[model samples]
Target chain A: MTLLTVENLTLEFDTDEGRITAVNNISFEVNSGEVLGIVGESGSGKSVTAKSVMQLNPSNSVYSSETKILLEVDGESVDVLALRGGKELRTVRGGSVSMIFQEPMASFAPAITIGAQMVEQLLLHKKISKAEAIKISIEMLDKVGISDADKRFKQYAFELSGGMRQRAMIAMALSTNPKLLIADEPTTALDVTIQAQVLDLMKDLVVEFNMGIIFITHDLGVIAQTADRVAVMYLGELVEQGSVRQVLKNPTHPYTQGLINALPKLDDLDAPLTPVPGDIPSPLERPPGCVFHTRCALAEPRCSESIPQMTNHGEGHSAACFVTAEKAEAL
Target chain B: MNKKPIISCRDLSVHFPIGGGLFERKQFVRAVNNVNLSIPQGSFFGLVGESGSGKTTLGRAFLRAVPITHGEINYSDGEKDYDLVDLPKKQLKEFRKRAQLIFQDPYAALSPRMTIRDIIAEPLEVMNLTSSREETDELVREMAHKCRLNLEHLRRFPHAFSGGQRQRISIARSLVSNPRFVVADESVAALDVSIQADVLNLLKSLQSELGSTYLFISHDLSVVAHICDMVAVMYLGQLIEVAPTRELFSAPRHPYTQALLSSIPNLDPDHQSDAQKLKGEIPSPTNPPSGCKFHTRCHYVVEHCKVVEPLLEHPESSHDVACHRWEELMNIKEIPVANLA
Candidate 1:
């Protein structure tokens, strides 16, 4: 069953200058117990799309004709987009879904104890007593490998290390046993060793809890390790989506190939990073044709005029490009 | 042949006292404890460690941003030698002009209120390296050209530029003073993978042209492996191993070094799940374990390893290890570099 389905999601930001389209007509589905990786550049609308899942966008964000997110709960579909206020959104925000952000420090309250926050979240989402909530929060912290859960329970966010704070945040997010977890650059702030540990913990939780996750990050190396299925986003569009093996090993889109090629290899230090030649077009001056046509080496004149729709290439693999799979193979 | 080391450290240590009270003696956090490093003239010496490994503190000690609690940091550029620890105010100002620092965050490092030209020229004006405005502009333009920054962009503030361009501006500013030794503290760590190469190449080219030594500090082993000639591994304020990049990767003598080298994710499909995962976290530097600091989590720790602190001993020319059981563990061959490829 599809745990979450976003269809024709178009979001525009009404700024002082003019209307800017941030996410443009994007659609994807997350199944139960699936880890979906959203890979993109800095301004690739990856975070915006993930944020849209929990309705966390700014109030100034403008919606187009149709932007539907159908979240299935208890065999009933809920129109999450129709949730007008925090009261209604609260039903899905923490009860059914939870999010982890890039900077743990920013997400956590500086003055309040982490345990209090976790217990409060648990009480808000579930019908549990204070004592029970506290017990559950401590267990979750222990599960996440906090050295002394009881001692750390009373400590503020500033007292914890970067890795510890991140773990605490994860523990808090998972305390509600949310069916869907939206993590946006959760490990970007931590070092590689701690990142690996957190990744392993997340994967373990996904198995133990049987929950779907939307992992958003700019690093493809990270996506490779955690994502079961991957989606590549470029400049407000979903360029490609497929199983992790197919997407990573045999990436069909030129942009995806360019990104993979651009990554510096740890083993082959001699190989130079072949950066896609041109800079990403500013969001205001978005190109009419393929969004990636400006930097694509294999772009044709046709690519500059017509926007390509998503086309299926193989099992669970699709790419939005005018170039055929055979031609892309030749490149 | 003895032109003297461009930068040398003899028992360098930087400690921070925390938890002050009557009951507590104010225990010291040994940020950089007993660190000894020697960077030859024009050599790019790499410092590799995870966070809290004191790599940044060590780098700052060289630049005099952080005070040296005990020991000596000697600086020599063939003509003059200065004991960096005991430099007088007049000589310290001169030393500042000779040694420069490249910060990690280019966004924060470059002033948002200043234009690129002013940001680059500020160093020159502050150090009194140039006399007239035209001379400053000429040097700024030269450095900007070398860094591949557009001359027109120099009129704009750092906000107008991307992370890569801002980093280029930062590099240009650091180079404006014409420093002999540069400490690039995770300079390229914040950049995109595509831009990291460009910045690294620029650093390499600048070194060749200027004949400057770089104390390159980064947590990314792969980035260091590509650019650095010699690599040093640090764990809990101590240097565990140091060797040529290729030699260290191929045959890491210390267990910690071996674990770090193997922990780098291999892009190759075959080596995905087989990468040796490092167990546990880095211990706190405030109260590090006795004997070998890494013994707490070391897989091969024995009774002797727990009781005796291992000294940094040379195993080969330009190669050093700080583990007592290295000779015993030498038989356990490291993961082949070709396997990752």
Candidate 2:
């Protein structure tokens, strides 16, 4: 079942220089019990799209009038963008959907204990007493693989290690039993060994909770290991979207292909890393037509002339490109 | 194999004194403990470890950035040889010109107040390498072009450039002095994946063009595997394993090295790795475990490992490992992969 649907979401920010579009008209859906990976580089607007789901964009952000963010909660659809600061927005923010960030330390309060923060969040969403909230928080902490939860509960966020702190953050996010979780680069700050442990924990939790997850990261390998379906973003545009296997094994978009080829593969040690030529254009200097044409190797004259619509190649595999989309259609 | 090493160290130990009081007992934090290694001329040697593993400290020790507690570091560029530990002040200035460092954070490394040309040419001015203003500008422009930076952007400040461009400026700044050896400490970690590849390629090409040995320090094993010819693993300020890149990746002897290699998230979803998952966090460096620093988390750890420290031994050519039961553990093959869910 589709838990959330974001349609024609366009966000622009009014900065000191001028008004700049951060997220172009991009759309995707997150279904329950599925992990949707949004992969992009800096300024790719992946984070902007994720924040838009929670209505967490800053005040200067200008959302397109046609933009629609529908959240299905208990079979009732709620338009997220229409919600103001009220009970409905609160319910949607932490009750039905919760978020975990890249820096666990920044999300957590330094002065407050981890258990206190988790208990407070739980009490805010659910009608429960302090005792019941503490009990559930302990259970969530243990579920995320933190040992000695009782003692760790009393300790402040700074007392826990980096990996443990991230786990605590996850536990706190999951304590509300959210239907959708937005994890933005949660494990990027962690070491590789700890990253493996966290990834395994998340996979296990997804099965146990049966909740949908929007995993946002730049690392293709992490997306390949966890995401059921993947979306590739480039300078505020959704360039490609498909199943993990299809997109990674046989990527159609030139931008997606460049991202995959740029990574240093563990299997092929001899292959030279081929980065997409040219740097990513700054957001202020938006390119005409396709945003990625400046760096794309297979860009044609038509690519610079007009924007390409998302052309479907096969079942659920779509790419926005002029050259490869036409070639796929020709086949 | 017979060629002399460009940079060699033996029994290197760098310790910093902590908390001093009139009546309180003095303590020390041994950042780099008895590390022994050699970087072959023109070889890209990699150092891999967690944050507290002292890989950065060891890299700094090569450039004499840190005080050497007790060790011998020999440096030779085939033109000059200097004992790095207690070099004279006059010779130290010359050594500074030959050895330079490329910092990890591009945002912090370059001065935002200065123009890109001034940032790259500052080293030349400080070293007094060039005679006139024209000579410095010519050298800076050449270095900037070599690093693939747009020559027209030299007049712009650092804030005008992006992360990858700033890193290019950082590279140009470090290379402008024409150093013999460069220490790149997590240089590409701050950039995006696509930009990281671009910087890595630039560094590789520059290595061949300049013939400068790089002591590449990073926590990413896959990156080290792709770029470095030889790699070393560090744990709790000690060298656990050192081997050729192919040999280390294919057959890691130390348990920690093995765990680190297996923990890398595989790019293929269908491939399920049965490699042992390391448990617990890296122990606090101030109070590291005795005997083997990694024994606290090693799966195959024995009672003997807790009592006796193991020295790095060359079990075969070009591979050194510091583990007591490596020979016995080598006999047991890795477990076959189970069905993927």
Candidate 3:
């Protein structure tokens, strides 16, 4: 039931200084009706990985020959990375797989009415008349919980509130009946209450539509609330991958443990925050061995000399850390 | 807890005029409206709110960065007292040395052109706190070390540092002035989670070392819960609730406070509290709703809430709420903590 499988995704960007690896041989899969949360900080390449799924990376991006992004569409497997800008690409971009950004305002055209944009998007993918497209767009808007759909449809993006605009973007993205939805920090720009509302809406939509979502965000709380499975990334590497409960409650990797510990818990107010020591190394100056070895508390001497392979810890929980892998093996 | 307040505001209000034309009537955007609070000496006081909640404006008003439209702000440091609203020109410049601000965005706060050393020492030189260049450099170096920045980093520009490093530099610059009062407006908001904790710990340690009073303004509730001694919740530029941090989190009186607390996404995946989520966006400040500003969004809102503006009622020694039905709300038996558990 795997909707998309991204294997050995080594994406490098050609910078003026040199070619820098942004996502280094990362592998993961998104299954049907599943929420795969990609949790990471600034330089984790979570966004780059998500972008690769839609082939949306900039022209400077260089994917390794071994890199493979396979998408299952209508019982047929298609190589997503091989797609160039055309009707076929459009089908993958907005037809089957849709993307939403942190800033909904940026994705939408300010000059055009939301209704026009939604209708235009529908027309682009679906072989339907303008009238039929308009009907579907309004229905989609109403589906995402935008009140007075007909009125809101006529108004431009600027006329709507932040939450409403996000909803509109979601509605547009969903209007195409996209199989996979890439939500990149969808709720980061929103207020807590608004965020809660949006999260609730997304959860409801996922259940109703049974769509696979690749939720990318830095907020662990949001990930814990929404995601079924989680992937922890650091410095363009997948440091850990497991079910949300397993990863959150019993994280084996020092980096994962550090990230969880760093968060301020409302339930346990007295616990002192222990931040992961040192800053994330810049992409240009990526550490030689395990990228996290520089800051990891449990890092051994050997950790600084070799990259750790992903070791299975019971069920689907896997961590890429030499010490943790050894500990798991011992257990 | 009984220490004298370093800063206190009495019916403070900050307003900016908008759209004043020959034919059109002049109107004011009530940024900070009638906020009354006190920051006790050496206590980390938190101001929590949404974007238009006036928390930033209130902090700015305290630092005299924004013009006060009404009421009075008083600053006292156990020795000297000054009415900040109408201080003399010379005294105002002197007051600058006593109070300082730490901005949210580390990337923008530090001047990219200046070296880390020059940036940290600029405050001291402007205030004329140190007499010689060597004295300034020594003070800068000491502050930098205290902030956990390497002495070698002093020569590099801000562009060379990461977000966390730049934030440390910003903190060093703010603290180098030896200010008694520091207004930190979303100081750690820009930082990553791990780095945020580091900066928060540093701030806590620095506060203890210098015994400086902090008016920590942030939109983040969890962060405020971790750091602040006392918490105040603002809605539409008005203070709706104020209580001790523990009490406020444990048992919030105002419905707005309750909704806000419940809305915070808990880390526990299994524990989804059935707390009522608030509806609608904050009303526009230009044409705010009459009476209670939060009435439109409050779940327990009644007809009385729409027309009658409830004044802040001191129900407990440490707790204050502006809700008319706070007493009745409290009288209800405690909701099961099972969801939270």
Candidate 4:
């Protein structure tokens, strides 16, 4: 079943200069027991889209009238964008959906103990006693592989190391048994060994809890290791979406190909680090047709003239590129 | 390994004082613990390690940016030999001319108030490398061009430029003086992947043009493999392994190096990796492990490993590893590079 669905979600931020559309008519669904990896560089609007699921965007963020965020919980459909600040909205925020940010230290309150924060969030979300909340929070901490969970409960965020802090944040995020988890660059700031450990922990938990996860990062290698299905985003546009095997092995879009080529792959040691030519255009001056045409090597005249629609290439694999869509049609 | 070592370290260490107050007992965090290695002239030397592994501290120790507690770091580029440990005012000033540093964050490295041209030209004026203002401008513009930055944007401030362009400016400033050795501490970590490749390529092209050595310090193993000639692996402030890129990747001896190499998530979806996942986090540098600092997390650690520290041994030519049972472990063919299950 689909745990969450976002359709035609367009987001615009009203700045001092002008209203810049941050997310341009994007849509994706996260089913329970699935890990959907959203891969994109900076300014790709991956984080913004994730934040929109819980209506966490700033007040200036204008969502289009066509935008609809539907949350399915216990057979009840909820229009998330329609929810105002009340207990009704709590069902989606921290009740059914949980978020973990890239920097664990910044996500937490430095003044509060890790356990206290976890208990506070749990008490707010669930109808449990203080004692039960504490007991369950410690269990969650132990589940995430933090030893001496009892003692660590009283320690502040600064007391723990970077890896430990991240794990604690994960423990706190999972304390409520959230149905859908939005992890935005959770391991991007961590060391490689710690990242491997965290990735393993998350993979195990997803299967155990049977919860959906939206893992967002710029690393293709990371996406390959963790994500079951991958979505490639470019300047707020979903350029490609497919299974991890299909998108990584047989990438049809030029931007996806460029990103894969740019990475320093360990297997191919001698491969040159070839970056996609040209800079990502400023948000104010978004490209006329395809957002990636300014930098795409395989861009044709049609790509510059009109935006390409998402074309299916068998087995649920899809890419929004006129060049690839025409080739697939020709075949 | 045969090329002349431009910078050499002999038991160099940097211990930082931590939590020492009038009432509290004075303690030290051994950031760079007794590391001995040599970087060949005109080669991109990589130092790889996790956070708190002292990679950055060791990089700064070579540049004399941080004061060392013990041992010597010598610099020799076929002309001068300066003892970096005890350089006086005159020699220290001259040493500053030959060595430079590139910081991790481009946004934080460049001053926002300064123009691009002035930012690049400031190094020359500070070092007194150029005689006149016009000479400085010419060198700055030439360096900017080499770094792929438009000369027309020289008059603009750093805030006006993008992340990639700002990084290019920082690179231009570091190379304007034409330093013989550069310590780039995670220089490309802040930029996007595409821009990172561009900056890395520029660094490579600059190396060929200037014939300078680079101590490329980063936690990223793949980027190190892509550009570096010699790679050293550090764990909790000690050099565990040092070898040529191919040798280290192909036939890793130390369990720590093997685990670190295997931990890298391969881009190939079908490439099965029976990679050994390390058990715990890196131990605190404030009070590291007794013997091998990595023995606490090493998969093949023995009781003896916890007591006796192992010295780095050359089991093969050009490969150095600090492990007791490296040879016997190598004989046991359970694991190898290109680890496919």
- DockQ of the candidate models in sequence: 0.44, 0.50, 0.63, 0.60
Model 4, TM vs. native: 0.98
Would you estimate the TM-scores of all the predictions?
0.95, 0.97, 0.98, 0.98
- Looking only at chain A, give the TM-score of model 2 against the true structure: 0.99
Q: Candidate 4 docking: what grade?
A: medium
Point out the higher-scoring one by lDDT: 1 or 4: 4
- How well is each residue in B1-341 modelled by candidate 2, as lDDT tens digits? 44578999999999988877998777888899998998898999999998888999999999999989999999999999999998999999999999999999999998889999999999999999999999999999899999988778999999888899999999999999999999999999999988999999999999999999999999998899899999999998999999988888877889998888888887887777675888998988767788888998999999989989999898876899999998888888673221221
Selected candidate, larger lDDT, 1 vs 2: 2
- Stronger candidate by DockQ (1 vs 2): 2
lDDT string for model 1 (A204-310, tens) is: 99999999999998888788888889999988999999988898899889998888887767667677767666567778889988988988888889888988988
How does chain A of candidate 1 score by TM-score against the true chain A?
0.97
- Please give the ranking of all candidate structures by DockQ, highest first, separated by commas: 3, 4, 2, 1
Query: How displaced is residue B302 in candidate 4, in Å?
Result: 1.6
Off by over 4 Å in 4: B339-341
Candidate 1: misplaced stretches above 4 Å?
Answer: A324-331, B1-4, B19-24, B268-270, B333-341
Query: Which candidate, 1 or 4, would have the higher TM-score against the true structure?
Result: 4
What is each predicted model's overall lDDT from 0 to 1?
Answer: 0.87, 0.92, 0.92, 0.90
**Candidate 3: which stretches are off by over 4 Å?**
B333-341
> Residue B93: error of model 4 in Å?
0.8
